[model samples]
Target: MRTAATILDFQHVTKKFGKTIAVNDVTFQVKEGEVYGLLGPNGAGKTTVIKSIVGHLRPSSGSITISSYDLQKEFADAIDFVGAVVEYPMHYEYMSGYQNLKLTANMYPEVTKARIEEVIELVGLQGRIDEPVRKYSLGMRQRLALAQSILNYPQLLILDEPMNGLDPLGMRDLRNLLRSLAANGMSILVSSHILEEMELMCDRIGIMSHGYMIAERNMDEIHHAQTPVYLVRVNDPEEALKLLSEEYGEQLHAKEAVGGRIEVETTLISASQINRILIKAGIEVQEIHEKKQSLEELYLQLTGGAEIE
Candidate 1:
């Protein structure tokens, strides 16, 4: 569970490029020790929100607070406990990974050799921490970037598209790393188009559409929101379907016969409830099982079939 303290707050924040509104009246908070994800299709302003937090693009209106420090008024103080990696993480290709980290360490105060080594090990790059970054694979580079972001032991970590170029194994590694960090008390705000990964990684997710926040939900809420599909074996399939259809109207989908069973899809009624409804209607149900929908299905439904770019 996250502490009530707000690590990051966007209070009615809005951003505009001339007449174009990039972010509109967005307000949310990332609680302490939570991994909050910003999810949307491309051009939905996920990147714009992230950029505003890191102070790259100033919000056109409203305010942003980081650990209670006003971002606009106290820029340095607000960003003191913040670390971020946005878009492509640039590094000196010619420099060894250790040397690159050494250069970056010069910019922040109190970052020591021990901290650098710890972050390197934390990102699983101890074996190749001394290699030239140019020779490293994309996954390895992403790991290195992650190491850099946390080298200062920031209280808040911001990541934009952190899993952009990773393979399956790399994505898994990144997810594990993030979970480990969050457990250690780091609050992370991440933006990504990867719904499945977000579903797996995030504690809570805020969805966006057309630069507007459409919905926000925690992991458990998302899980319970998945419309349940029930497979039922009854004494009479055709009669049960007719009874359910007539009783429930369009709310139930009791169709498609499979052997002696009928697969029913419904959002409002559970398998047990459906079974009870049939039993009360004088239909004997032999078995009932609920099928869970994948995160992709839920995402599409929530976004109204708006494809994630």
Candidate 2:
């Protein structure tokens, strides 16, 4: 893709706070109309990476580009099409929600009051639009934060822990809202501890750990796994087990039926050879398919069983 075609790109980007490398030489690309998830445990360089991309923190080395604007050389132009909420993104507590949105809009040269009201309504805060932000709940604040971010109709929206303090209903609404925004050609980078939500919301996901991008995958790659597992389903499992023991017992794993199917994880065996062996033993292979692992399982396997932080 040309530089302008890519909404965001981090090439060998590294960020350091003193001697601590918060974000290592990370590289990733986000295309337009895609919600790219930056998922990781706490202290996994997630926040640092987001901060670097959105102009809060500069990378110590390497490069980050937003469309045709180089982050280092064209900071203002790079940020021109970007709008974000870095953290809690608190507005004036004493001000009404409408007032807060108005002030935010006023920061832009040509932003009008009507545009402010439009964004507030879009975020579903219209009923309480005149209420003070201090009285707003966590979910309300999040909604307002989103409203502020979209006031510019940003080409790239970077939200850090956007679902931080939202209820289930709010999270669901936010997911739908983000999907709609992406459909409108806005690229988004959302970093949140909500892995399940990310799994549902994002078109692609990148896992970060120990200041490095551990994995990046599209929906299909993230969801459907091609793990080298053999799922053995047979009419006579006892006979089938015995036949397997007589032949390839060493590669066998957890020889038990679960959910009406016998599962085995092994060093990828050939489907034709398995069929031939089963036919020769007269084991009546009802269904013998490869078992694919889920994203959650793959995550645990790769991350040394670390908990989401």
lDDT of 2 by residue, 103-220 (tens): 8887886777788878877788989989999999988998998999999899999999989888888888899999999999999999976678899999998888789898887877
User: Model 1 misses residue 155 by how many Å?
Assistant: 0.7
Worst 10 residues of 2 by lDDT: 259-268
Q: After superposition, how far is residue 64 of candidate 1 from its true place, in Å?
A: 0.4
Clashes of each: 0, 1
Q: How far in Å is the alpha carbon of 296 misplaced in model 2?
A: 0.7
Candidate 2 segments exceeding 4 Å error: 1-4, 224-228, 231-290
Best candidate, lDDT = 1
Model 1 lDDT vs. the true structure? Answer: 0.88
For residues 1-309, write the lDDT of model 1, one tens digit per residue.
Answer: 534688998999999999889899999999888999999888889999999999999999999999999999999999998989998889999999999999989897799889999988888889998899999987788888889999888899999989987989878988998998899889999999888889999999998877898888789866776567788999999889888888897787778567788888888887788989889988899998875465566567678775764
Cα-based lDDT for every prediction: 0.88, 0.84
